[model samples]
Target: MELRSSLGSVATLALVAVIVAMLVGQQLGQPILLGFVVTGSMSPTLEPGDGFVAVPPVLADDIEEGDVVTFDARELQGGGLTTHRVVGETDEGYVTRGDANPFTDQDGDEPPVQESQIVSVALQFDGELVVIPSIGTVALALQGAFGAVIGVLSGLPGGDAVADGNVETLMVGGGVLLLLYSFAADLLGSDRGGRDRSRSRKGATRAGLVLAVILLLILVPATASMVIPSGVNEITVVSSESPSSNPTTIERGGSQTVTYNISNSGVFPQVAIIEPASTGVEVAETTHWIWRGQSAGTTATIHAPDETGVYYRSISERQYLGLLPLSVIVALHAVHPVVAIAAIDLVIAVVVTVVFALAVGFQPLRFRDTGRDTSVVDTVRRTVRKWL
Candidate 1:
């Protein structure tokens, strides 16, 4: 019975962790481990409220035709992330189409989907999608509840200050509170009448589960902070003989410097690197260290073509938490931004795991047997009343 109960607890915790990941992924607009469709574009295969396991591009094998991928769509649904099946390969990119659609995306305004734009691939087994029915519906309902709570909190006295903070920050705070409440409820409801119960109750598994939850609470927000704000910044420039005061207007055959503000609104200090993404743009300073809730600026020089014309240029920024040395992060980022993120996450997980293991070795946390007769529900009610 004890072994079965322990297994049950572990399974419950795992389910909760997956649900939390899905919720965070939705809020971050990235498929952390799962992705879902809001429309019936993939109906019959994956219904509108269904979700599927998403393997990040970094971890997944090479993309191939017939694979369902989630990519940054250039035209479909007004240019956002879209999930569709790869139908054909071209020199330019891959042709994609919704499973239920009669025509490929290229038949419309959307161009071929590039490999770089693909974020995740839906996991499949035996050529069938691993679907989680109605998970998206549950996630959407929870998100709506979060928004409602934020609205209510914003209306309270001095609550606007709290409500105005980053949504991810609020989410982390709420998650912590929820965890604490769950622990409290579990503690209050546990039966403590029999001495045999105390002898049989082994808490090593529970302790490990708690530690896992704590680690996730740390990792999810840290990853989001680095990812949510980092992306390409596109700037338009008009090169002409008569240059205006606008920094974007450059004299033909000359150069203009524009300032790009880098801000860290998260709770942790961050190190950011900005690099030129186009030929005409060059960053004056590629790296910056920013304290939490602070901002910094970097300059990018844009050279106008000899022939007067309007042009577009871009710069990309990648950031990581200031947990590791600047030089190490820079070296890892040189390989790929995702590499740096993965390394940082790995380090954090290792350090936290070691600390937890040292602090709470595998042992049963036995409670004293009090000779009082009380129903579990009554005990919980009494505990709640005392807190109130």
Candidate 2:
């Protein structure tokens, strides 16, 4: 019985972790470890609503032709993450095509896939994709249910404001409420009369689990804030003798200044750093501090080569929460963007850990044995009735 209980606990924790990863991935607009298809793009290989393991670019081997990858598409189906197979490579980028498509993505309005644009490579064995059937179907069902709940909640007073808030914020709030309800149900419905001290210790374990969930609730979005807004920005430069008024069009051996806007729509202030990611791109002011609901502009000079037709230059932007000193953040960013993100996340994690320890301590929460014999459902129903 104890062995079975332990296995159940492990399974529950694993499931929770997967769910949290999916939620975080959705908010970040990138798959963390898992991804699914909503359309029959890959068809026989990956049917609609099938899920697959997504290996992050950092962990995956070098991308090559025939490898299925999930990349940020700029023009395909109005721009989002698209999973397809790399069919060819070019000096510019990779040529990708869906398994069911007749032509390559580059044959259409979609540009060649850049390395920076690829988020994850689908895991495969012997060239066959490892798929989790119907997982996306389950995810879609849960999303529909959540939307229905949100619709009902929107009908309540002051709930319209909450419904209009950020989706990630809503997810965190819903998670907290669910955790609280589960804790309450366990406390109210457990049979306490004949329970031994060992059984009471289980409540402490449950409390720790709740704490972990709360920690994830706070950290996932924090990490996403630092990661999601940071990526490569591409600039196309047309070089010719007859230079146009456009900033991107310049005479050979000349340069033009292009202004880029950095905006922060979130509640937290962000520190943004822009750096040249490709040749012939130079940022005038590399760092900008954007407060909540504000925008900042930075200028970059695109230099055309002595003998040029058309060229592409990239500028990389990295953002972090305004939680640490600017100097420290800048120094960490100089090392690497990931290093800066890790440092910021580490600082936030340490602060949150210390706060939680100060408030809750290392001990498990103790629950009194009130000898309640009610079922969890009954208890929840009664509580809801009382509140209503």
For candidate 1, give the lDDT of residue 136.
Answer: 83
Q: After superposition, how far is residue 114 of candidate 2 from its true place, in Å?
A: 3.1
lDDT of 2 by residue, 279-371 (tens): 788898998888999999988889998886877778988889988888899998887677788888888788877887888877766544446
Candidate 1, TM-score vs. the true structure? 0.63
Q: Which regions of candidate 1 deviate over 4 angstroms?
A: 43-47, 57-67, 71-81, 86-96, 102-119, 124-196, 200-220, 234-257, 261-269, 276-314, 334-339, 346-388
**lDDT tens digits, residue span 1-388, model 1:** 6577557666766666666677667655678777889998988888998999999865677788889999888779899888899999975568998999999999998867765577789999988889989978987887777677767777889767756656644565466545654665466436532544476553213556567767988998789788867776767688899888998899998899888888887777799999986668889899998998999998889988788877667688888998888999999998778889999999889999888889976454333345554443455466569899
Best by the TM-score measure: 2
User: Model 1, residue 110: displacement in angstroms?
Assistant: 5.0
Model 2 residue 24 distance off true place after TM-score fit, in angstroms? 5.9
Question: Which pairs, if any, clash in model 2?
Answer: none
For all candidates in order, the CA lDDT equals 0.78, 0.79
